[model samples]
Target chain A: MIEARHLSKLYSRGVYALRDLNLTIAKGEFLFLTGPSGAGKSTLLRLLLREELPSEGEVTVAGRNLSVLSSQEVQAYRRSLGFVFQDFRLIPRMSVFQNVAFVMRVLGVPVPVQQRRTFQMLKWVGLQHRMNALPDELSGGEQQRIAIARALVNEPQLVLADEPTGNLDPDLSLEIMNLLREINARGTTVVVATHDRELIRRVGRRAVTLDHGRITEVG
Target chain B: MAALRYAVEEAVASLWRGRRSAVLSIGTIAVALFVLGAFLVLTVNLERLAADWSQAAELSVFLADEVGADQQRAIEEALATGPVVASRAFVSQSDALARFKQMFSDLAASADALDANPLPASYEVRLQPGVTGEAVEELASRLRQVPGVADVRYDRQWLDRLLAAVALIRRIGFALGALLTVAAGLTVGNVVRLALHARRDEIVIMQLVGAPTAYVRGPFIVEGVLQGGLGALVALLALGVAFWATQAPYLVPLAAALNMTAVAFLPFITAIYLMLGGMLVGCLGGILATRSESR
Candidate 1:
């Protein structure tokens, strides 16, 4: 589902975020990207998301080169995937329902369908009762679940989570991982970037470890 | 459809959140449009006044007191033969005095104190329809050279001057309106820019989530449009109130002095165009705000 070939991202004046990396993940597979700070895990996720252009080489997903997509095409491509951030990044002013329905709204889904799908997703995440609650009012675990619901509401083929449990307690982190596992069981590809080796062991999926911008180990 | 709905809702909510700036922008637009609308009202009425007077344009050839019968016959013959002359009425000196007295009753007592009627006999000559101002002037010049013709006055000359003044006013109105509109547009852009700055995080999140450009930037544009639209409406309402206030207290007497029947407010179509112009300006501001963000 994802491929990177000799991918190297350079920063200003001799700073390298990612250096000559190559990796591939099969379709519908759940994969973990484990790395320390400055190990280029988030950089890889950004490349996959097409948020920035690769300074050298290319990243391809579902057979389309991410670097070559037009602005409009990039938007369409991003809509085809779900992204969960460490901060959850729900619009602060939006209610739980609005946060989830926002993706469908941007896609021009009819209001009624947005309501139905948003409700179903919230229900699945067990946050349906907090539909009218704002992001600031929700607990850390509840907010993360709301973010997960938002990610899956659009029914994306691939989901990328960048430290999805970074701000949560250990128990909440496990709960979020379990929810991601459930999403992956439904045949959606999932890639999570984190440094939690214990959590990686618990998931027991294919995991790649990165050190100094290069993949050092894979299991 | 969904995008449009969201844009509207977001625009309104954004404006509400930044109501102070929104009001300031709207007020600027209102003041600008009000100035333009004032000129519009002025020129419209002046044009109407010119049209009414043009319909009654004629030449007045005042005769000398010692003018002989033969000189009168020569003038009458010239009037009869002129192609521009539609009709002519000869007012005797006494008849001219009586007409003046009837028209100005307050001045009758002063006229009665005179031992003799000082008013001159004249020919009131109506011109044919569509006679050019130059034609009337040329005809008046010719009559001035005729023997015993004391002075020749053509209404078309003054009417032409009035029209030239009206044209100048219209041009000035447009020039000032253009400048103010630019200011208004920039003000709206500034306000929207501030809103964009406040929502920077939300914007990043929207972009990361793959919201289309329209969904992300559409609200700002819509906000500008609302500002412009509301500004125009306020301007129109103010214009209406000013028109009503001045009509009885000032415009009526002024119209009477100018020999005009009545002054008119802006036409319905013109008011609508003014409103639409406001909206267009607001749309431009929105575009300006969003354009910088795109960079």
Candidate 2:
């Protein structure tokens, strides 16, 4: 569950990154945030993640107020959600297994459980064969899959993917999007930010469009 | 336990990944600690030598020739009951003359040319342990007041000068050691900062994945402690080598005089304190480096 009431972010005097934006999404819903560059989609996700606070109003995720959580509490809150970045953000020196298992490691899951779940998640994302391969050695598609596996390994209730397919070929982008769809079908809420209308059309999820720091449409 | 192991593994991994920086930091710490350790060794031995000199201080109460056996006995009784006197021995005129001749064997013929026994009888006075400078002076004044005692003398000025020099050396050594410790800490901080810069991407990713600040900072702290510890070890090794190299016939007598074992392993207490100090410096450096925004 999530709620944002009149959330606005001001980067500087006379410049607004997000202007009094308000939105809501139910549990287990998959949504797309679409807009041109500088449309506040990333800002909204960052606010949800509590990486930065809104200049005005509040955002809540999983019943916890983002504005009021202490830094330590914010970190704990983040652990309950998953994030997939456009760049995959894998530690290049680490193997695929390490990349995916990192989330579990942070959460202090027992070694045996981490191994089992990481292997299972990698298999689900069709990356089990590349477990020992470094991020640099993997294809763009494989790397994204590894990122997806990492995000899902902790079984977070909500997953936020910031332009998850921004660096991939069309075919690879579609594959990554389909994997996200599969994750949503398995009951994880997913919100993706991207301007790729073709991919948006292909997936046909509920879409929220923003422009000039305000949400312009929703379908 | 599992989390701690993971943290330690991460720390070791970071050190390995940034081996060049680690080496540089460790070397810097070693050099700083080496200077500190050398100063400490010198100060410790010097203090010991000063203490030995202070403990050996004695007062000589010379007696007049007109003092007969009865007056000498009276003075010996006064000395025996003196609170400051730990021990005392009477040196008769004959004994004193023999000692003077032995001390100046080249002047034996000159001494024999004297018509009468010129040496005066005296009482050699050893004071109680931990007697102060004022106490020594008071005892000397007391001895001068004794019946038939002509002169009471001790090397008070020389002892005072020796103590003052020791105190000055200690103060300077403390200041220099503190300055080098700070330098070592900053060097470690710079190294940690470089390691953080090299792994910035990983740090960002770690944050995004919900790793706590402690989790992210833990490895750097461990790295700092390891660097400091290794540096201290190197310094100890160097000190041991230097001590060994110089502990032969050159310092054996000095060591024996000071009642210290020749080239014995660094006193356990001193070694422990030095290691603890090194670890603290490293910890400070780690904390300084982690104060910046890692994400």
Best by DockQ: 1
TM-score of each: 0.91, 0.95
* Candidates, DockQ: 0.75, 0.74
> lDDT for model 1, on a 0 to 1 scale?
0.92
lDDT of 2 by residue, B1-295 (tens): 6556776788888888888878888887888878778777776777666666667778788999889888888788767845577898889899998999999999989989999999898889887656677878877787678778899888766778877887888788778878888888999998988878888888887787778776788878877888888888888888888888877866787788766555244577888888888888888898889886452
Candidate 1 structure quality by residue, lDDT tens digits, B36-148: 99999999999998888877888899999999999999899878845689899999999999999999999999999999999999999988866778888888888888898
Top candidate when judged by TM-score against the true structure: 2
How far residue A179's Cα lies from its native spot in candidate 2, in Å, is: 1.3
Fnat of each candidate: 0.77, 0.69
Give Cα-based local distance difference scores for all models.
0.92, 0.85
Q: Which residue pairs in candidate 2 collide?
A: none
Query: Which of the CAPRI classes, incorrect, acceptable, medium or high, describes model 2?
Result: medium
Worst 10 residues of 2 chain B by lDDT: B257-266
Range of the 10 consecutive residues with the lowest summed lDDT in candidate 1 chain B: B74-83
